[model samples]
Target chain A: MKMDVIQPFINSADAVLAQGLECSTAIGSLSMEEEAYRRKGVAAMVWLTGDIEGRIIIDLDPETAVRVASKMAGAELPESDSLVRETACELANQIIGNAITALNDQGFHFRVHPPVMHMSEEGIKSSEDTEALVMCFETPIGSVFMNIALRYNRKRHADAASAGH
Target chain B: MEQFAPVKRSKDGQPVRYLIVDDSVFARKNLARMVESFGGHLAGEAGDGLTAITEYDRTHPDIVLMDITMPQMEGIEAAERIVQSHPDARIVMVSSVGYQENIVAALQRGARHFVQKPVKPEVLYEVIKYVLGDDGAVATAAGAGV
Candidate 1:
């Protein structure tokens, strides 16, 4: 994926995590993944369709998920609490929604689907056109992983190009 | 959560009733907490736009905190529908998506204001005050009920 597409997610994650956690966050790691995604713990996946198409997954270890949920809730929550999973999904939704908003302003129209729990252990493998880029954001609470796999809709691009001619 | 001076309806000095609409229960809870800190009452909650419409009719809240993206029906359309029936309805679009187009669209469709997700309590408090305008009054610290 081009930096233009990836940058928004990075910016959104950093901003959202820092603000939500009330602490500074750093990019712990960044790498491209071509293999099928393996969920680290509680994962939430959000899909986008329109000018861009594909999905983004936000993953957090069970412990981290609990801590993050507790911090956001301003109270202690046990690991078994369903709110932990809900927190993960809401975090994913906020991160992806913010990123999509930035891209939309840059002229990419998209419909952001609601986030759902990524129940499967392994996710679909990335293709050449939509190679996944994984970014790990290190916050005081824990490491938040954002797996982004997206591509411009070539047909829409071509249509826009031809229509402009 | 930091407490703000409670805002009450100018007409009755009662807590401002609110309808919290969002697909995520976590998000709804968070917003509920924030509104509570603002001295607002949770009149109702809805998981989607369709329910939001019904809840609006049933509860008749003083304000609506509506999420933009949701299953069944989106917040913008729901806001429009609510405003069509209740022209004086105060609907605030709360979502993670804060793009110019979405903000403008929501405003045009009858939203009183827009607040981005990962909401800051202070900002939302100010927005509630602004949106309520003359209809809302912030009670003095001694008189604050919440």
Candidate 2:
């Protein structure tokens, strides 16, 4: 049976936009669905390990992605700037951290290695048989997908995620 | 007064009611668009600290997302005031590490969580559930909660 793992991710993303950033949203927009999807321009990729072995690639269009990236970078993105990729990686890192905590409350645990965010329409190749979960978010330039990949061989730990004791 | 729409809940029975605040209109609209996907209600909305404070007082939101920096009463200031009044205010501060100063200031002001830009819905939802607890049900759907 499929654990409703993605539910927590979507909640984390909405919280990030609604509560984490402004007394409101600072900028940007999002949508949700299931499927391996793609968009034009840049994508932010964050790797995952531990109980769940997989990678989450959050892909976005350059223009909209850049606006999001610039906020994290604390500067405005120049027209056609190259930093979109870097920003996407950082965004992925934040999303992972937040999502893990939400999952932890549900008796889940995992260790995330250092994330390497970058861009690629094709993205870092995953093994063909690897199970993947992809979620797409829409923005001005286009849509971006947040992909969660997991391998079954990893030892799954259902422990307390953090220090809530 | 505009009536708030009903929100959904997780199998665990957590109601997602969100209060979104940001100076940028674009960001606000973006968040408003898909808040329901996370099973979250638009508890209320605000553009700055003063507005945040006012809304927080009225709505007593389950989550408060404030940007580290903005025009007129920044997020840090808003968080401090929210915490001061509602010591239990669940505030998750937002900023790119590029603005370490803002992030630091917000932490000092008593934010419970942190998220970066691009504001993915799943990422935000996860943190809110973690911090606010599974008690997050919409006020309107009290009977419908799990």
TM-score, candidate number 2: 0.43
What is the two-chain DockQ of model 1?
Answer: 0.81
Query: What lDDT would candidate 1 get against the real structure?
Result: 0.91
Clashing residue pairs, backbone N/CA/C < 3 A, model 1: none
Quote model 1's iRMS: 0.9
Per-residue alpha-carbon lDDT of candidate 2 for residues B1-146, written as tens digits (9 for 90 to 100) = 11243344444555566788875444554566556555566888887778999999999877777764455776778899999999988898754322344456677889888876656556766676677665564334555555
TM-score of each: 0.97, 0.43
Off by over 4 Å in 1: B144-146
Instruction: Tell me how far the alpha carbon of residue B91 in candidate 1 is from the true structure, in angstroms, after superposition.
Output: 0.3
Give one digit per residue, the lDDT tens place, for model 1 in A30-134.
Answer: 899999999988899999999989999999987898888778877787777477688888999889989989999899999999998888999789998888999
The TM-scores, chain A only, for the candidates as listed are: 0.96, 0.66
Worst 10 residues of 1 chain A by lDDT: A75-84
What is candidate 1's CA lDDT for residue A88?
Answer: 83
Stretches of candidate 2 off by over 4 Å are A18-39, A70-76, A80-82, A118-121, A124-129, A140-142, A152-165, B1-146
